[model samples]
Target: MTEKLFSPYQFKSLQLQNRVVMAPMCQYSVTAKDGIPNDWHQVHYVSRAVGGTGLIIIEMTDVEPDGRITDQDLGIWSDDHIPAFAKLVDGMHAHGSKVAIQIAHAGRKAQDASQPVAPSVVTFPGEAYKEPRALTTEEVVAMVHKFAAGVRRAVQAGVDAIELHGAHGYLIHQFHSPLMNHREDVYGQELSRFGVDVIHAVKKEMPADMPLIMRISAIEYADGGYDIDHTLQVARAYQEAGVDIFHISSGGEGPSGQRKPGNYPGYQVPFARRFREELHVPVIAVGMLEDAALAQAVIGNEDADLVAIGRGMLRDPYWANHAALELGVSKEHAAIAEQYSRGY
Candidate 1:
């Protein structure tokens, strides 16, 4: 029987062979403090691509230096960074695994001691972030350009897709989540408009064939975090704004303990499914979607269209192939680099 995990998912341009997607993870490796792609990134992503994962979403890349979360985050605000990303793309494509890049700005979550900016003057629980200087209307408009340019760099690097980082209290998240965005401007009043503008603007620069995914933490995971009900509305708005897949994540800002009770495998699937049922668009269910059976159930039950794996993929890169075996089907590690194969 062809299991749910083995089924194909069709985005705008590429066809993903399996419902399993490698979640974009921050490895905290950066070279020259420019957020440029380095060797660490090359091996990290290519390893997973070759390990039989379906599509790999690269880590959160800074659109500008001030948007960085730390000294080690990847960046794509310039043309120089594209060359390195292109190499990473070549390796990923060699393994037959499609790739996506998550472009972001850290908002108030920028590097320690450096003045970080956000829609409001907020601070993460215990992270080292400088007091942010709120952006003027002109600066806000400039941020859009920076974000759009990141898409161009990713496209030049030959990636198949691009996911805007709108979760976890980053720049977009700051705008989307009311708990963080305390501004009184047009950007602040419209919950949907905060992220929609950038997503829509980015579409212009991104490859037409490339699918654009909006990765959002459906719930802000804080006491006064963005409301889930409102987020559902935001989900619909993004679809209208030209998003291809809704990658649902949860919690990053405010108090983490205030999050909804459950976080087990497939726990977050319902949120993704709800968006899918309501919006009728592709949704990638993320967070703790580890086990093969759990992942299978989410897709089999029509709970979500895709399962995104983070720690699980790190725990075992050959998860997709193994999952295929358990589900009584066939999948290959053809994406794995030849050098890493045992019998080479």
Candidate 2:
């Protein structure tokens, strides 16, 4: 039987060596204090490439300094950041892996900002979080432009794709999640408009064939979080606004709730399947899907087009390589490095 997990797949202009994707994980190792890629970022991502991650999505990189979740997070707001990212992109490509960056704005979640901003004057529920001031209609439009600027820099840095961080109660999520957004303006009247506007603005800077991926919280696990149907409606709107693929995750809109899912392997696979079926678009499944057999089953059954390894990849930089061997697939398929081939 063909091992679908290791099979190559193409979308738009990207061709992956396998179905393994290193889901964006924050390193927070920006000791340089400028948010530029240092040796740490270079070694961190390229090691995953060497470890056989077909695609590596960098952590939530902010478009502005205040947009960062923390001052230590990566940023692409300046032209100087391009050269560092370009170097990282080159290293990943050298190892035959496509790379992407998750452009984001933390909004009220910008814990490092003296004053965080959101669509409304809501504060994230926690002692660490402070109340955020609401953005004016004019500022909302400007935020869209900030995202567009990030897109331009990422493309200039030669990334394989771009994934907007629209989930996890970030700025985009803050604009859409009714639990946080309480504006009476057009942004509030239409929940998905901010996301659509950002998508449209970002698309203007992208090449015709370059794909745009969106990471969305398909179902909120909070008490008043949006349900599957409502999330699906938002996903369809994003699809219409030119999102090429959906990376499905849940929660982060609010604190945990009665509906919060238990921590289990492949617990979020059903959400990916639902989005793929209902939206008729490709979806990437994430969350606790670290088991080789479970990930294989997800792909073999066509539950998702791609599987993102979060903690698994952290535990083993060669998680994909290990999965290839454990699944009894060929070592060549794993693209094991010549130096590491003996281990395989």
TM-score of each: 0.93, 0.98
**Candidate 2 steric clashes:** 0
Clashing pairs in 1: 35-75, 50-335, 50-336
Judge candidate 1 at residue 68 and give its lDDT. 78
In candidate 2, which residue ranges exceed 4 Å CA deviation? 30-32
lDDT tens per residue, model 1, 88-174:
999988887888899888888886427888888776666566778888877898888899999988998999999998887788887
Candidate 1 Cα misplacement greater than 4 A, ranges? 30-33, 331-344
lDDT of 1 at 14: 74
Q: What's the residue-level lDDT of 313 in candidate 2?
A: 93
RMSD of each candidate relative to the true structure: 2.4, 1.0
Candidate 1 residue 229 C-alpha distance from true site, Å = 1.0
